[model samples]
Target: MAAASGDNPSKLFAMPAIVADRRDDGSILIRSTTPLKASARCVGDWLEHWARQAPDRIFLGERASIETPWSTVSYRDARGIVRRAASWILAKGLSTERPLVILSDNGIDHALLALAAQHVGVPSAAISPAYSLMSKDFDKLKSMIALLDPGAIYVASTKPFAAALAAIAPLHRATIVSGNPDDADALSFRTIAATPESSEVATAFAAVTPETIAKFLFTSGSTGTPKAVINTQLMLTSSQQAKAQTWTFLEQAGEELIILDWLPWSHTFGANHNFNLVLRNGGTLYVDGGKPAPGLFATSLANLRSVVPTVYFNVPRGFDMLIAALRTDDELRRKFFEGTKFAFYAGAALPQNLWDALEELSLQTVGRRLPMVSAWGSTETSPLATDCHFLAKRSGNIGVPIPGTELKLVPSGDKLEVRVRGPNVTPGYWKAPDLTAAAFDDEGFYKIGDAVTFADPDRPELGLFFDGRVAEDFKLNSGTWVSVGTLRVAGIAALAPLAQDIVITGHGRDEVRFLVFPNLAACRALAGLADNADAREAIGHAAVRSAIGQGLARLKAQGGHSSGHATRALLLAEPASVDGGEITDKGYINQRAVLTRRAAAVAVLEDDGASEPIGCAG
Candidate 1:
């Protein structure tokens, strides 16, 4: 059952009716009316479909700058290139043990290479470029190299990753492929693209089965070193069918569906969800070079000015940056909201302030508010188990499951642990049999480790809000449990744009405190400081401290109990360490990683005399 449905124009983006099957064990199964059935078994099937049906259509696009023209790829052209690349791949004799490894940002080359590998039986692993470019010790990169022992490694340029490549060169016997010419040993990407197609390429593509492992995407390593999650053709294709059923707008739009995405292909959100969704629906994707980070967001803003997409999707942080642009730039706002039907966010729970701000912007620009949607899933679930297709009244509404997937809510300690069983879910982790065995329940459902609570207990179809991970939540000194995920969203909303993310402290302590990571750009803007102000100087400003203090008072004023409010807080200037697993490439903060890395800072928050605190109202 949908929350509301009537003649209201603003409710044009209303939710679909939910079909539920409730069990006696407090476990519930929710799904959509639209059945899930794959039109194509493998991803390559869709590529071939569009190539034959709409050969001249643009499948993917990218640009170097605002002034530059987009370099486009047609479906027909992509198929030819993929076949040629596959022939070259077959020449090298790639197998499961010696797979293809890509270490670079997203591009046409990256997309074609991934498609080529999956078109055959070889599994392609897109390792995060951050590990190679950002890390100082390269310990994580070395570990990954040891685990994969790739048969081939591809990078956009040899110059940027030369040191990282050299460090791991002796570890594995991988053939190097690079787009740029700096590396002497690496094969040229252009040369591979020029390889003639072979008859064996068609046989290899046709032989791919549902059980064939198509990709190996590593987890975010939020709590520890990343584990390689095996994504099969069944997992990826079934998930897309579920999506096509729920989000009918994609099918309705036909080949007209357009998207601009910057999320990394290394992660499932970009690779499986966004990228695969476009291919499945026969749409065009503009590979956005801009990211949510302040410096890089300018590129995103520039891109938006030029191209307005039909369906927009990003993480909450990206919206945070985009909202600021929407508020002041009328031309950008008009272009963004005019053709956009829905805005989707994942990778984190969105703050309510950003939610409200987007609705208001839509109403102001379009004379009607558009739907802001989101879903809940993980890298293992093909990243789409539940999707919110309807117009939710507020934020944090992860609607019922898409068709073909069953959600089993098992009772945990005062929380419901969400488990999933379906073809869309991954079978296991790569090479980690024990970990894979431990990840499932007795009935074979994957134990996702997340907790959920219904929006309305009497109405199962209304949707569910994500509770904190069962392991991340902790009991206070008073034995009251603190839901870190719930409270984090509330705190971010209370602090508005000032606090980008808050690490809830006071675990097993008398009360909850916060180690606040200030959104330096927003804080600087609020403080009327120079653009180049250092983090320390920016966060120490009188205006910034006052805004945070006010936000704390507001949280305390609306508190339900001790765990619901932060009694003390401290602003931190040091950003989250990527190597320490405190932040993912997708801009999601790992609460557990932050707590572990900033243990001393949290300790100081518990002691009033140790640091100057932002006091809460009693």
Candidate 2:
């Protein structure tokens, strides 16, 4: 089972099997691996099963404080709390008509409340905390509140969200529920959780069917206001079942699984995928307080030192930071890789440099490279459609379609627009019938806006690589379509240690130009400066520009066409704005958002009189 930890985990990996049929109409039907049976009809069924079978097992845990010990809730205890909470919720007449709106980050209380609502046929929507706590204007928060019109709104604490709640107080008549009930308008979470379980709780639970709406997960809203993607019970259960089939190591390990997760429950990747993965498998989840941000990663490092997870999940940035830590901290390196069977990355493509660095560190610490895999899907697809179930040859290989899912690769311009049809996929968006109608095709497959290509066209089993978002790709003035995804990876690889991210801007222009967001730390290190050095000075350093020039030359030399490489580039000192939607909380860039937000930067890149632009050989 640990074979992938060192020599070759792929030997035990289920066969990389795929069946592909190409039609004369230029579409392909691709099916990979046999379908698996769903273990549960609804997400709550797993909680009930574990409560009965493994009553003493810890379901969830988190630290109360650095001075205090970790707080935990067993399956038996969780079920009791959930039942009591559900009774209180039902007493309030809260059903799917008026869903529960959550405004807190991951915690023991938050998870239980959300589960309890779903168990009793009421949908719970976990809105991103940034909308409530971080924003000063509260415009987004107001918009979300108006959309949800929830029967009750939950906040872990009142002080942080007090102002935002005040701003949106007039938007709806939701009953405010707070963990700290100091506010006069709010109900105490403890008071609600202590409600006596009534017969109505069982009746509500019995009425939940596979089609019941479990939750409403909002998209990152990179393009517009976040749309509430309706997640049904079938969607969640089917996705987990498909995951269980591919991840055979979990069952093989034969012990209760442990996870340290920081991904917000507001997002489907964390909520439906990571959260449900642990619960359905009868595993323990430690809600990580730390994030990939520089100051907060310390918390994660502390947690990792104490608790080594059997399987790890993170975005590319987290892995990037972890690789840096593992290089210097010997004890951390050992503990992180210790008994860890697999390393999973998603939210964005893992850079090849980071991928190679992790492999090298694993070789040094654990004497074998663990299977670092990724999956491709969206919130509408229940967060998983295609999974890299087998060993991939390189980065960006999103693998093949998972069991019980069929992928239709339709010809679109030069790329294949990937669409999925499966039980795991969502039926539609919440309260948006028109948008929902436009989301699927006549065959019932959801038109996921992403594109993909076979890693090896001859051998379909080799897996499929993410071709990039079909919407992000644009044409040049010369009528050549630029593959933004392919070029972005190449540009980043060429400019390693200098450019952290690049926004390709050449729509309707003669040539592609890059708005490069320099890696400030790397730039400062090369310039012999301190970590707190000014971003403009670090980016303006002659050595930094020279390194970027070399990278441009490299891209020029390896170019396939004018559209495949940038002709000029400019370093941008501005960071991606989370509020402006230029970047997501997960550190994934929104290409269209950045381009629209910084239209001036694009004009500057094309201006001949602007500061002498760095030029490539092409």
Candidate 3:
């Protein structure tokens, strides 16, 4: 049910609809549509149709190191994998609701485990592989499992996940299932995958209905406890339909898309949503666990350099590194962009410079500039909502809602908040009815607490751009409101040439200052700047000058120098972390945590030490 419709030419045109109680302050109320019974068919149960129409086509992927470039895990094979995986999971003491959990690098095993969960009408919580291997943040991993109450947790045997999983096992309601074939305590994902092909997977799993729980994706939990959002079978199915419908509107047939992502499986971007969109139409997926920085991830990139994907999805940081590589390396550039058709970015804000660079490179390689677009959604919305399609228009706005989605702008004090309701949208937060009740308006429109504006007034079909998070915006002591989200994003872009990022200070303060982090690479490139004493002095000098210029420019851009955005000072040093005593895994700069850890830094911010801007992750 769409909350916003294309009928009203003033509010919404021939696109997605929005129905909200109109307010005087340039705002419209978006209300949810009445219930309608639609097909319960879900994307995870992909076997029924694919088995009949194109049983020979490749539906899932085989790893790069394997002998086959990709396996034709036909409709039949997919079903068999599901059946075997379901059987194996059930045999390992898993129940319908209490399902098998996977925390592995993205691969076919995910598809198998996912479908098996769908078949049995169970919701497999796909935990992030990064949490298990990459030690950026560890405590969150244990908390996520405790919330899910999974019957079994699965991990790759070769990886160090077993040890990590073991550390967190005491908190889990499930048994541990190792992905490795050699592990004595684990069920071999490979051996279970060897089950003979069968059509029974469809028929056997047909009992799943619209009400059946499809997935329980955990929110990124940046500021609070990790929330388990319920995803139903119909929710996923409708999202796929909406995605396929949106793709078809662009006049493109089914594409042989290949995506390489390491954004982590725990997030809906890499797990529940992106993968579902790919499988909706039978396409190839190259599971790349590569990192943009040098080391093992580099080796993975070297291996993937040969397969030029038709569809590429990467984060803003990763795109910067990839573009630099494409510009410098001829072989990589050719292989990477040769077959590349479209690119999508997410996980963070895409900087204007990076966006400009990508447009230029795409033009050079493809002879016609390819669209660099993205989408906006969360696990709360089943991770499918507004997609930024540059095909119709190329402004920076995130695209309109999928066919079934309804979005409205609920008027707030000097801000318009977003709200949506549709099959793709999740019902509510798990075991938090109070949260669920508070989450939606009277008309049942699920509130998305982000600020938005209609930048393109001429075309209502084009959706709005993000203004800021409602809570993240606050009033300075001077009574001037500060949008921290917008400010942080702009600060990162403004200092792109020098600083990596900045954390804005505006909590009960008269003006906002930044803790800036200088770009290590750029600092190295500055003349006379090295790790030596004289070099360090040179680096600090150049950095202070560059930072001062940026700060002044930032002040001017925000209007007058009196605006909250005007920088008061800058710290030449990077923020301390867990080891150094500053930042956390969520990229959260614990103000109190940092202040307690480094009284000197707090004193500096307070101007008791020096007028230095401490670098911080916003």
Judging by TM-score against the true structure, name the best candidate: 1
Name the weakest run of 10 consecutive residues (lDDT summed) in model 2.
Answer: 3-12
- Candidate 2 lDDT tens digits, 539-566: 8888888888888888888885889888
In candidate 3, stretches whose alpha carbon ends up further than 4 angstroms from where it belongs are: 1-27, 30-40, 62-76, 134-138, 194-204, 249-252, 293-304, 334-338, 364-367, 392-395, 527-561, 568-603, 606-611, 614-618
lDDT ranking from best to worst? 1, 2, 3
TM-score of each: 0.96, 0.95, 0.83
For all candidates, the clash counts are 2, 2, 22
Q: In candidate 2, which residue ranges exceed 4 Å CA deviation?
A: 1-4, 7-13, 64-68, 181-185, 252-254, 612-618
Query: CA lDDT, every prediction?
Result: 0.86, 0.85, 0.61
**TM-score of model 2 (CA atoms):** 0.95
User: Model 3: per-residue lDDT, tens digit, 1-618?
Assistant: 121111121221123443335668565743223223253376555665655556666665555552446443666677667777776655555654576677876666776777786776677777655566664556767777776667877776735775676667687677665566778876677776665534555454677777778777776554456677888887877776666555543213334455555555556776656776556655545566565443434645664574666667776656766776678877777666666656777655666667777667766766555556677777777777776543433424666666667777766777778888888888888778998899898888888778776656555555667777786677778887776656666666666655555555556767766655455555555543554434235436754456556654764475454443545445445434543324332232433344355555444665734634433222
Worst 10 residues of 3 by lDDT: 1-10
TM-score of candidate 1 versus the correct structure, residues matched by position: 0.96
